[model samples]
Each structure stands twice: as C-alpha cells, then as structure tokens.
Target chain A: MKYKAKVFVTLRPSVLDPAGTAVQSALTQMSYNVESVRIGKYVEMVLDATDESEASDRLHQACDQLLANPVIENYRFELVEAL
Target chain B: MKYKAKVFVTLRPSVLDPAGTAVQSALTQMSYNVESVRIGKYVEMVLDATDESEASDRLHQACDQLLANPVIENYRFELVEAL
Candidate 1:
C-alpha cells in the first residue's frame, strides 16, 4: 500500500529564526498589527509500506533521521491517506 | 485593514536538498515504494496594509527581499481574506 504523509518541521522555540524575525519586522513597518508570525517547513511524501503501522514507524524514523534536526527543530507528521 | 498571506517558499527544482534526499533514501530502505518527495517552507503573515493591492505588493517585496532567497528558492503567496 502507498501512504501519504504531511510533515511539518519547525525550529524549536528556543532557536532563533532570523527569517521569521525579519518578516515580522517588515510587517510592523507595513503598519500591520500582526498577531503572530511563524515559518516552518512542509514536506509531502508518498511511501509504499506494508501497513499503516509500518508506514507510521518508517515515517517517524525518517523524520528523526533526516526530515528534522532534533537539536534545534521539532517535527510532526500526519498520515493523510492510504492509496 | 489587516490582510493575511500564506507564503510557500521552495527550493528551485535545480537546487539539491540534501535533507529531502536523505529522507528519500531512508524511505527506500524502509521498503516504501516512494512516489515523490518535496520539502518547502510555509510562512503565514498578517500584514496591515491600506488595501489588497498594497498588501500584495508589500508581500511581494518582502518575499523578494527576505522571505525567500531568489538565488535558490522560489516563493508564492496566497492572500487570504482581510481581517
């Protein structure tokens, strides 16, 4: 079966996101009473696994090993659907 | 008025994404007959602009200036409803 996943990887709260900060500054200057600004990554992957459990496990491993940097970022994955 | 924008910044197809490539390799090892994999950044910005045109123009400027690295990344923005 093929499984589709949406992974969101973001810098941890303690880490500095210069890109996000710069955008926030620009918004302020543009006269926007901004609520909040966050920048993160969205990754979509289509994988072939035996079952949902296996797919989930493998996807988690991928996220830990490559999709995100555990040292400075946190990651989450949503198994969208089976194909 | 306040306007919201969702910016998606992605590496041009030409640039190599080591992180995404690594994940693809891991997925193959996991026996996932992968379809495709792409990784990109999603940014949500709330801006205060006089109108839609101004908001869009400013957002475009922001994307070119800092939200994305034109050299390696391409960015697209969706203007959400006004607030």
Candidate 2:
C-alpha cells in the first residue's frame, strides 16, 4: 500500500520573515487593514512507505534533508490514505 | 495588538485532487518513483485580533468564508507572534 503526506514548514518563533513583512506592508498600504504577515513553505509528497510508521519515517527524512530548514523553521505534517 | 495565523486547507477524505495527481504523475515519470499523490492549499494571514481568542475567531471566519472550500477541504491552523 502507499500513503501521502502534506508537510508544512515555517519560520521559528524568533526568526524574522522579511517577505511576509513586505507583503503585510503592501496589504496594509492597499487598505486591507492587515496587522502582521508571516510567510512559510508548503509541500505535498507521495511516498513509498507501506504503513503509517514507515511513512512517518520516510516523511521525516524528506523533511530533514530536503523539505525544510530545521535551523530556522519548525515543521509539522499529516499523513493519510492517498485515495 | 496583532496576530499571525497560518491556515492549511486540504481536500477532504473523499475529494480527488487532480492537480496533485498531475504533479505526482510527472514526478513518477521523471524517475522519482513516487507512489500516490494528494494536494492541499496553504494560506498565511495577518489579522487584527487583540488576543488569542479573538484571533482564533477571526481565523476561523476567514477560513470558513474565504480561505477554504468547506465542502471539499478540511482546514487546520496555528497562530503565533508575528515578530
């Protein structure tokens, strides 16, 4: 069997998000009444793991090596049946 | 004074994600050896809520009315200090 996971990786609490800041500023300037802005990365992956544990492990590897920057961003995810 | 929320809205258990399917097909064709494919939406919003409770309420409203297709996707979120 196969599984799918959606991984969300975001800037840690202490990091400054300049892109989000700039976007928020633009939105506010446009009269959107925005207060603050945050920018994060989104990734969806389909893996070869057959069960939930293996899927989680492979997903973690993907996140650790290529999907996210552990130095500055915190990551979370959800795993579910692909179909 | 301000708050930041990251909203992730994904296809519900039964909805098919064609875009994600196409992307996964491409990956497999490229020798990525992928299994199944699923796709979801990611949104980041900066709101004017003064406290956590209000922020949650505003975020929920945003997700309900504008951020997600409630009929097909389930939404999840996290809130944190912007800076």
* The candidate that achieves the highest DockQ relative to the unseen native structure: 1
C-alpha displacement of B71 in model 1, angstroms?
1.9
The pairs that clash in candidate 2 are none
Which ranges of candidate 1 are over 4 A from the true structure? A1-19, A26-35, A48-83
Candidate number of the best TM-score: 1
Clashing pairs in 1: A32-B48
List the per-model TM-score of the A chain: 0.91, 0.93
Model 2 misplacement above 4 A: B1-33, B36-41, B49-83
Across residues B1-83, which tens digit of lDDT does each residue of candidate 2 receive?
Answer: 67777777778869987876776676666544467665665667767756888878767765676556889988899888666
lDDT of 1 at B74: 92
